[model samples]
Target: MGCSRPGAVAIVSVFLAGALAMISLVLPYWSKMEIVTAAGEKIEVALGLWGACTSVHPPALDTLTAPVIANGSEVIAIEPESALSDSFTCGSFYDDERVRISCTSFRELANGQCKRREFRGPASLCDVATTASFLGDSTAVVPDATVSDWLSVVDNACHGIGHTAVALAVLSAISASLCGLLLFVGITCGAIESRLGRVGGYCAFATATLQLALAVLWTAEAHPIRYTEHAFATSFYLNAVSILLHAAAFVAAQRHQSLEKEALAAMDLDGGIHADGAATEDKEKAMGSSKATELVAV
Candidate 1:
């Protein structure tokens, strides 16, 4: 049997979902904030699983939306330059082990150097705590916030959470790849009831479910202080779209399987009726031949 329309569409959806997953994995724009400075300058900060990126935007841009105004009354003012300090700040605050962590946004080379800061690396929450301790004054201040105190303040939210999230994301990608492989084989063999097809559908659903969890965890974990505006960035949105695609693929695969099973059942029924008719005709012919022989003998 040739590949059904639903099967073809499911395969396409799987391919697209895998592509989106890969792209989202590498790009570092999971969460974003626009910080309005005291000088009317805007600094955009993007946080990702691997790293963080910051860019200075001029206040003259009228198209800027989602501005987190730092008016000391509404949105507490934070020093734009001090917020995501350059790699130099990491050196001043963090020791040698923590200082070397490099997290550049989208892997871009800023001034031919990577953005090396406490908040840029995969262990950004831990690093951010250290930086916050050094900064002293914060909009969200914990009384007597030492480095360890800050850690406890957030209830050790950074402890292995980022790494675990990264692991889950990778697992999601791997599952998606396996799903594509199984789906491709099913399409080629035209087997609707193939165990491979069922497994592929399971994989797709698993990927979607895991990604949804990751999205929720990331949103909950990415709340840094002193910013009023918050939004999920392009990479985050891409993963979300990928999740939907995977879900759609699962539905299509199920439909294709059902249609193929029904067709197979119909074919079996028709073949059984034809066989019964042929057997009855053969039996009648044998009876007539015996009667003719007996009459000749008489």
Candidate 2:
């Protein structure tokens, strides 16, 4: 192929790199989560796989029995009815209190102070719902309606310069720079008709595309209101896929350059033979001239 053929590879590489950059920036925003407060306020939360751990927990001992307090001071003890109802699991905890309430917010009593409640058996002390609202008129009853504010807190934390966000930023910058370099190499190879360069360009393009896709997928799967297990799994899978694509592309580019060099060497050898044949003809002509001169002189 002519040197210009590699131009296509360069073009592809650049397009891929641009895509990667766009996705890297977009994914974070897409995966953002928001918490809606009981007062109808919305708080945006940015969370990754690590943040999921804090939101999910093991269920309290009594899943069915709601905490009952007497006169704002006495904690009630329940008799062990059955192990089936008391035993808690991670999913159970997520479903019961953890999913519905913010970990930082404590349940407030009628006097607007945080209420302290005890658990019977091996129950979690953090199970009491902390979120509350003013009752209609003047009566204070713990509203059955509880709001989950974890998303808000998580969003607020993520919005700040946190470890996860900072790490992501650093990773994205590095990947972007590497991608740009690969594209430049591919372009240079195209100019020289280097087979390896074309190949490298192709590889760079492929990797950039994959990286961008992963970022997009991660952002798309994140929800502002709800937390699901599938979101976490999808995020991890996307990241893995991106990494694999990046590696594969890099290898392909390198191999392409190697092949190009071999082809170039072969061409040079063929040209050298033609030049050697011309030199041989010139030598024969000179020898013939000397013999003719000697014969005439004799």
Candidate 3:
């Protein structure tokens, strides 16, 4: 058969690894970054598998990443402390999927203070409902005039890199699953000695090991650049754990093969010893009979 008891255990381990890898892909297994705005307000946000959720909107079932706060389309205060006696509304426009700012303005007022304005131009992912209102100044749109951009820039520096990381995570999970399956098939086949079965097992083990190494290497590469403001979520770790389990199974299978070979060699040695002992006994008996005949002749 393909495997003895140890081989069976390896098969189980591979299956577990594959199952966990698939689960990791679906779970919200990335980091939640709590970005603090100028007003010392903590904005909780998570990105990757479950999508992007910002503390700006409450967690929702519909979007992968929704705003935490429910104040739809409100001003994201870049300069929350700056007094707005004459801070007129700046016009906004979409630059690709993201909105761009041309100037600044107030949207709402309470107690003679600006309470809401436009976070008006944020990324597509963060276009969640805000309480930001228009500055009602259509004349504020500037054409080719040279004007300094307002301080209303949202901190989405990690966003572009985060998307790249997402793709990597997905690919890693898929590769891991495939390798795990190969390992499983190799261990469960009763025809362990068959060329196909042996090839399957070896290929599975090699692929899994290589994938694990590559995943770690890629994570290291992304760490300094991407995760400076973020972190790895539970799902990422789970995926790594799956890869580790495959390694464990590979080790187990190797040990089992070693022991099997040792047993066969020992058995052959024992048979040879027994045969030699029988030959020696037959020779001794023949010699004794000849000596007796010679004695009788004397």
What's the C-alpha lDDT at position 197 in model 1?
A: 79
Q: What TM-score does each of the candidates earn?
A: 0.67, 0.41, 0.50
Q: TM-score order of candidates, best first?
A: 1, 3, 2
Superposed model 1: Cα runs more than 4 Å off: 58-125, 128-157, 189-193, 223-227
lDDT of candidate 2 over 1-298, digit per residue (tens): 3233334444444445445454534343323333333433333333442233212221245535644434466443323322112111111111222222212112232234432332332222123332112111111321222223342333433443233444454555465555656546545534455444555455555555545554544444343334422234434444554455555545545554555677889999999999999999999999999999999999
TM-score attained by model 2: 0.41
Each candidate: how many clashes?
A: 0, 9, 27
Which window of 10 residues has the lowest lDDT sum in candidate 3? 142-151
Candidate 2, pairs of clashing residues: 31-219, 34-224, 45-155, 46-155, 106-130, 107-130, 196-256, 196-257, 200-253
Error of 2 at 46 (Å): 8.1
With candidate 3 superimposed using the best TM-score fit, by how many Å does residue 288's alpha carbon deviate from the native?
7.2
TM-score of candidate 3 against the unseen true structure: 0.50
Rank order (by lDDT, best first): 1, 3, 2
Tens-place lDDT per residue, model 1, 171-250, is 98889899999988876585667778778878899999989988887766674333246578899999999999999999
Those runs of model 2 whose alpha carbons end farther than 4 Å from true positions after fitting are 1-25, 28-46, 49-165, 177-190, 193-231
Candidate 1 TM-score, true structure as reference = 0.67
